[model samples]
Target: MTPPKTIRAAAIQVEARVADIPWNIEHASRLVDEAVDRGAELVALPEFFTTCIVYDERVFGCSLPPENPALDMLKEKARRHRIHIGGSYLEMRDGDVYNTYVFVEPDGKVHRHDKDLPTMVENAFYVGGDDTGLMETSLGPVGAAVCWETVRTQTVKRLRGKVGLLMTGSHWWSEPGWNWARGYWQRFHAGNGRLMERTPRTFASLIGAPLLHAGHASVIEGGFLVLPGTRLTAPIRTQLMGETQVIDGEGRLLARRRYQEGAGVAVADLQLGAVQPRAESPPRFWIPKFSPMLYFQWYHQNAAGKSAYRWAKRTGRLRTWDDGRNARAAAERL
Candidate 1:
């Protein structure tokens, strides 16, 4: 077997507007251009980079086919730049909507992996996807885990010793009370912030490969409110934002663009040739704190809920993302 080759990689961080395809595509294209100018041979974009999220009725209306126009735009960018590009998008296949990652070769050939599971609020919008998450590229074997999927025990375990690089695209929400509290805790605790600052380091260490994490940095105005609680004196608007980070096989941070730093590109050299896959124990299952979302997900996957879901789809009653009011109501239903 041949050793993995060294590759210069870049992670682009940009805020995407929900349902705004043109603006998101433009910004992502410019960021990829910036990375290429910085001598990056591989560039990655954040999850749902083209259209952040739409949970209500819009989600059903906005799902894209495999050969959708958005993909054509991304493929063109990869071909124009002659660089490997990794990105995730919302896809509708058969009757399911998926959070899917696509790896575009310099020749514009695209490979894809669906997220194994959706996290928290995401379950209301996307159905889980099934793919190996592993791919062979000119740079060497590469793997991907999307947003919250990175925290799963089996997600990275499946790629261990099988890939030289692992690409993670995320849209981790950041705000004052909730998100800030978690990030603060993550500094002292290893298992606290799996969706954000810790994923690249954790995946790299466990998978024995370099990991590139591209995340959103721009804040979008939304009706998402952090209700007053014992932790906070008053309600605050929830903002979605995070850092773009990269780490090497030894779990060393190579580069990063923090939330405070605003939108930017992160570049680092992945020394795949030096990687030595180390043996590690399989991660144990983590029991998350109880939440209404989990119960809703479980119900929806059951036989009775499955029938209701199919009927809703057929009748167009599944449009939970029509507006802020409907969004909240839909979330409660799930």
Candidate 2:
């Protein structure tokens, strides 16, 4: 089979209002319209674009069924516009709520994925998403994951040969305070911060394809777009919010507009030449080099209390989970 081709990508660096679902949806819908205007077949919104940066119980309380008005609105938009919407939503399922991302196709059909890892802040409210890796879409075998979810969402092993396009949504929150420094340092030192951002780019490189990374960067931090495969042709391209960024398939930045705003656009000839593979080298991406098997084995051994507790609920006595908080309260009395 021939190698995968390069794909044009647009990352929306939006300013999502906190706790406003209707406005968030409208803003995201507007972004989608703008992306289509620029000829972007696949467009991505920031994480939780359907609602404000809803965290904790806020995400659950605002949650709705797939058929809810918000989602239905998106369906009609996708079908009418002929664009694929890439992002996650806070969804209610089986009385419980989940932070889920859906790849809504142009036909108005949809595929869903839940976040594998909930941030420390989110642990207080969300249950972990049990599934891992990517889900398929008409665009190609696509992978959908949320921020922080990239860490244990499955070491890039499950990534290979499964999907050609890596679409990740990040609802990363940070305040310029003590906790922000603490959390930022953790992802930076361990998760490779900006550098590790290339995990998807590297994956696209390995399988000889291009990545459409729509970084969940909005408001405070701005946003980014990577095109290692396309960089050789033109490192600089316009991005959402009137900004421009030159990013490597390895998620490295070659150039960018330091401070810009209000929607921008960029495009790459996705059919750009092949992203050659190493002749005699082992896979250089994060997953292959790290010995994922042994690492994950130890991960759960020292996992956080929240993760451990969730695990018990999924595998032990509480296996048949219930969402009605009243039911649990009643069980406690029994």
Candidate 3:
């Protein structure tokens, strides 16, 4: 049988209560079941779906050498569902822990990608990942990013290549505008679009592939205030899982549904080839023609290079200085 040109991809979302391992597994698995039932061959889970927020439980007592419990469980889920199920995880290898996402196919084949650039908070918990962007599978090329990595210029450039569909798991948090109390959440939710609307649209606008941004929707410690003008004791962190949707190459929303926090699956058939070979469009982040060597020079001249720094230390590194000693020294030389 020939493979279908278009693929149905599903993005799974859950409320994700902290440290509820069995519950999180069950709920994410159920989403896979739903996606498969709807004829989806590809499915994606939220960033670190197995663990709650990184600060939640220290990755379940996992230390420098992290154990990949999530990968094993996800593999079981994929085998059971007879579909591809993937999620962010903590991976241990060679005595280093990383924030990684593992993909398990229906046939039990697993592919993994460690977050190439760990966010500030992530760097605290996990070391840097070895690779960036997506993972390829039998269905097609599926790319992934977590949280802030999706916004990086280079990573986003990499994601828009010959990849079939774009998927991302993020704890991308935003303060939902105004909240008065129990009754106030409705108003805040209503304003969420205005507050957190830029990036997701960018996902569709740039990739031309169906994208998913999964996040938690729960009250966190020191959450934002509900009352309009009252000061809250602590700042709470919360996330509302975004709905799965398809976008065409024109950056139009082909389909979108509500963000649900249950055993939920958002389904869309992606025909990636229909949007390519444009004759007159200027290059965005990931255009057909990309030059890394140009960036090598750009970074070398504009950004810090440790070797450059060391070399410049002896030669007097004087591009910009905070301590004023180097600048003052150069002024004296002049």
Candidate 4:
């Protein structure tokens, strides 16, 4: 299919309250409204926007169906705003919970894709999805990768020949031991945005596709902000907070929103019809085609990895944060 000459795409970087299901839905809806007000025809939200990335019991306890109220609200918003909405939620399917990204069209049609690779510690709560492909939409062939999936080289390669618009969802967090002079703390604190700048551009250049990355910037301690009795009393640290970036087909920064910046929508105009070829010519060097480390991790995280995690939980290598929601039992049934 021929792509559009141009489209107003928006990356919504907002604060997500953990496990506050109804509130998160309302908050995301308001942001979608703001994006529509800014003339965005294609809007994308950060990863797990409906539930801040958390492994707490509440999230597992309240796993919702694909047609749950939160998604229903997004559908109504998409129809009313006459725009496309994309984001994810903790979804239950076939008696298993998967982190699923739902793409909603103006006509209320929904396309779903599960996160094929779950990040560290996420393997415990959600099962990884098996299929990966582009979604045919009004904006042309749109595709996405949730969180760390954007950094999986093979995953990005798969989308190269299949998509024109690459909309991503991510929740990058502050690394451990955040200080002024060491490691990610220094890079994130005073790098003039260079640290966070390189990722999306690299993905765009590699994929040869225009990309929009929507990310959460709020200070989420343990990726859980609203959880009871765990809220920190100190001021929220702002290190390693992720950015919302728009990289063009030719690997140029079209627009961006930095960490801890005032929340709202960051919009970019992309000429989808002008995107580069689906697959660029192969490089001269016969470098390894895939990351053995990542693929190994992916393999273990699927079925076998869950067993290892269960052992860790039993042996005390892992600590369980129970929010009194019977999440373990809920996950067991799934």
Question: TM-scores, in order shown?
Answer: 0.77, 0.63, 0.65, 0.76
Best by TM-score: 1
TM-score result, candidate 4: 0.76
lDDT of each: 0.68, 0.50, 0.54, 0.67
Error of 3 at 149 (Å): 1.8
Instruction: Encode model 3's per-residue lDDT on 3-87: one tens digit a residue.
Output: 3366677776666655555567676766667778888776778776755543332232332123344566667767776767777
Root-mean-square deviation of each candidate, in angstroms?
A: 7.6, 11.3, 13.9, 7.1
Q: Candidate 1's error at 135, in angstroms?
A: 1.0
Which residue pairs in candidate 1 have backbone atoms (N, alpha carbon, C) closer than 3 angstroms, thus clashing? Answer: 56-320, 56-321, 57-319, 57-320, 57-321
The lDDT-based order of candidates, best leading, equals: 1, 4, 3, 2
Error of 2 at 182 (Å): 12
| Candidate 2 Cα lDDT to native | 0.50
Residue pairs whose backbone atoms clash in candidate 3: 134-143, 179-226, 180-226, 216-239, 222-235, 222-236, 223-236
lDDT of 4 by residue, 171-224 (tens): 765443334456645543444245355667766776667888887877654432
Q: How many angstroms is residue 10 displaced in model 1 relative to the true structure, after the best TM-score fit?
A: 0.4
Question: How would you encode candidate 1's per-residue C-alpha lDDT over 26-139 as one tens digit per residue?
Answer: 888888888999999888898988776523334444556788666887788778878888889777777676888999987878889999876644554567777779887777
Off by over 4 Å in 3: 1-4, 57-69, 176-198, 222-237, 241-243, 248-250, 257-263, 272-274, 277-334
